[model samples]
Target: MDELKGEWFETWFDTSYYHILYQNRDFTEAERFINNLLGYLDLPKNVNCLDLACGKGRHSVFINKKGFQVTGVDLSSNSIKEAKPFENETLSFDTHDMREVYKENTFDVVFNLFTSFGYFDDYDDNLKVLNSVNKMLVSEGLVVIDFMNADYTLDHLVEKEVKTLDGIDFNITKSYDGKHIFKNIDFTDQGKEFHFQEKVQAIKKEEFETLLEKTGFEIQNIYGDFSLAPFNKKESDRLIIIAKKK
Candidate 1:
């Protein structure tokens, strides 16, 4: 896998509507997803957490407000720079490529929310991030990977849609290439338009489980949504997994 090919993530997520989508009025729903995943882990309030690919500090801030110490990392310098103003004693953000392992056994919980895992252009490059994450977890530490239900996403695929957030209109289109899901976004505000493309690997559940197992993590729980309902192939909006280091 070519490492440099995945650099598009930095541009697509940094200065685009990506921030608006998660930080706008939908914040309540985002908070609910974070809290629900946290509840399933049942870790101590003071546990240290690593928010991988943390965008605009959404989930990171929520975790901090819940009394956990959080360190967020993202490839986007712009997002981290914006996140700096929102940090406190318990919350901090840094700009780093997730493929590189920095701290070992440093976090009791490593949270990768909102399908942030599959952004890499290649499957193996994506697995590098998971390998690094596996090394970051403490013994018996918890890992909560929140992603869209791929089967459902494919079954009820929405090829194109228009949505409004923070008074801006967004035209979104999706393309699934068997292994990758590409989203083309056009944002319009006050007659100004901006466009960007984001590609996330459309990795299936079995494939993800294989990645986890190859990286030496044991899959413990799999849920279809934030509510923690059991995963069903035909029904579910989200695919949330709780795994432990083996």
Candidate 2:
């Protein structure tokens, strides 16, 4: 096993075990969220869309099915390779960093879903991602960022848990400081023990508003969850923001 240091995602996300650990993520819920978003936006057919940090391209495939020209990009080569099989006339997958602009003024919609942001330790890197998203979008183009509500998450924190899947026991421990949340995962497979960590910044609504405004995005709407309910800071399970390029 590799040492769990530096950027944890670079090693953890590239391994097959990472896929196994998260294979049970609710795809149905994600699909429904995409459907609701599409219905609300009512975008014209064949519009260009970019799925930022699109691991395995599930959401990208869903968007492509709805008649959009979708391009899914991720930093994980393993994920991009797995997503390539789904590519067709209007759908494509590539390996790219979200902090850099892949294409300028090209996409009608740019989606950064499933709390994919705030991985970098440096706060400025997160702003760079927003700038990249802004640069990629056309005039008045939409950017949907689905993030976790920091306050709610810290209030409802799960400190520890154990999950047994496929005959492997995963011991998970979670902790949150004022600035970031950390998940420490330890498990043994075939008599070998391994440990990994996931760290995400606890970005609040006000921070997002400031970042969007600074990036030239006008806030259009905010939702509390995948259901698209209006955001309530104290009670929402998720923070979903819809902003338009100014």
For all candidates in order, the CA lDDT equals 0.83, 0.93
TM-score of candidate 1 to 2 decimals: 0.89
- Going through the candidates in the order shown, the clash numbers are 0, 0
lDDT of 1 by residue, 1-246 (tens): 112233678766766467676454566787887777777677788799999988778789888988899999988889898899889988999998889996999999898888888887667986798889889998988788888888888888789998888888778899888888888777766666677777888777888899999988999999998778899877988888889988
TM-score of each: 0.89, 0.97
Best by TM-score: 2
lDDT of 2 at 216: 93
**Over 4 Å off, model 2:** 1-6
Off by over 4 Å in 1: 1-6, 20-25, 164-169, 187-194
